[model samples]
Target: MDDVVRRTALPGRSQSPHDKLARGLGYFSIALGVAEMVAPKAICKAAGVEGIENVVRGYGAREIATGAAILTSHNPEPWIWTRVAGDLADIATIATGLRQDNNSKGRSALTLAALAAVTIVDLACANGLNSEKASRKTAARDYSGRSGFPQGLQAARGAARDFKVPDDMRTPELLRPWT
Candidate 1:
């Protein structure tokens, strides 16, 4: 006799269903913005210096809004979040300048501006912020990695071996006293 076996697929390999949904929505909005930006008439209207200014303002506003939101979040990784927000805000301002009054100069600045925007957006979408417990653990790990941290003290934690009192007799004292 022969027997048949069946297996079911497991989730969480690439992305959770929720993450996929969010990404799809985000991409869709971006597509719409691109379409608007590239429209023939829209391009003509915003082609010269004046149009670039408008584009810069629009992008800057978006960055400011997003940065504010991130900064205000109660996430445990507040430091990282704040940094990300500040970076975004900086990029937005640079991008505005890159748009330029006459659309001239600032090639390198424009490149950096785009990079900043992409990084900030990626962070926002990834939801990479950690919880309070995780943040604290990470902080502790970083702190312990510091130099001049007295390895002798850390090693003497349990046994109190290396932490014994000096051999010189002062008052009566116990070496390696137990807690």
Candidate 2:
């Protein structure tokens, strides 16, 4: 029947904060990766690191891959976790730079601090995603076919059929006691 159309959640529904953050990180990764790939030497020089242009370009590639994953994956939790791993690697790289007897120790330290902040955000977003997944799993098991509506689908359909709409209210007329 025409009235029996199936109802489902919309695909273009509003995104949660976590989703927005993940998307933002993905965009950030792509931008940063492009910058690094395009100007690895310049980046390293600005950061006070030396003789690691190849390494910087390698990191740029990794960032591009991670960003693409985050942008395209339906569940970006794993990708975000990967970002956390990348952050750790970055910290290690910066630490190495810090140990170098170059003038870029201060810049490396600042970079490390920034990486720490990004790591925190990545971890928080990953945890939130995991919790949301767990909650969905739990909710799916909460309702069984035989529990709430004991009479089953037919009874539910009958209830829906029995539901009445007041004609006056449908036309936006003044409310009055039903006689």
Candidate 3:
């Protein structure tokens, strides 16, 4: 199924803004995961939390897995949604740090704010992917004559066949809408 998705191309379909953002999120996740894994002590220190390097590393692993999944999947909605869940978990962890005696309250607050910003992006991407998927499904159905496009396949084929071209438009590339 994954191979099929990677191989198939939807004609005349451009990448939506949501798709771009989701891809960006995938990259961001990878970068963050690397940081968490390679510099857990620094991350903990900056977040004003102490003695949680192992926990930070575990979160890093989760981030890397989700990020890789998001990057590879043709339909990234589920993986993006998983990132949202992870964001919530991160926020919870930071909140706990705020209550700890050794933690810096100000730093914890700032971390929470940053996580909130990330959560917003995660949610927007997730919703966008969901809507995009739905529209694709609808388009597929219409193309297959299951719904929409009243005359369906026959009408489509006829339209294509009947379409006239100028004498100067000799190339197939010029005839294709996607071009």
Give the number of the best model, judged by lDDT: 3
Winner on TM-score between 1 and 2 is 2
lDDT per residue as tens, model 3, 79-159 = 999999999999988888888996388898899999999999999999988887665342221124254567765667666
For model 1, residues 1-179, the per-residue Cα lDDT tens digits are 00111011122322433344334434443453454344534432332222444554454444444444433433223434444554565455445544566543355365565557655655554454343223322221223434454675576467655566767666455655555
Report the candidate with higher lDDT, 1 versus 2.
Answer: 2
With a 3 Å backbone cut-off (N, CA, C), the pairs that clash in candidate 2 are: none
Q: Provide the lDDT at 16 for model 3.
A: 79
CA deviation > 4 Å runs, candidate 1: 1-50, 76-179
lDDT of 2 by residue, 56-137 (tens): 8999999999999999886788999999999898788777888889788888888888889999999999898777754532
Best by TM-score: 3
Q: Which ten residues in a row have the lowest lDDT in candidate 1?
A: 1-10
| TM-score, one value per model | 0.26, 0.69, 0.70
User: What does candidate 2 score on TM?
Assistant: 0.69
> Clashes in model 1: which pairs?
none
Query: What lDDT does each candidate get?
Result: 0.43, 0.78, 0.82
Clashing pairs in 3: none
lDDT of model number 1? 0.43
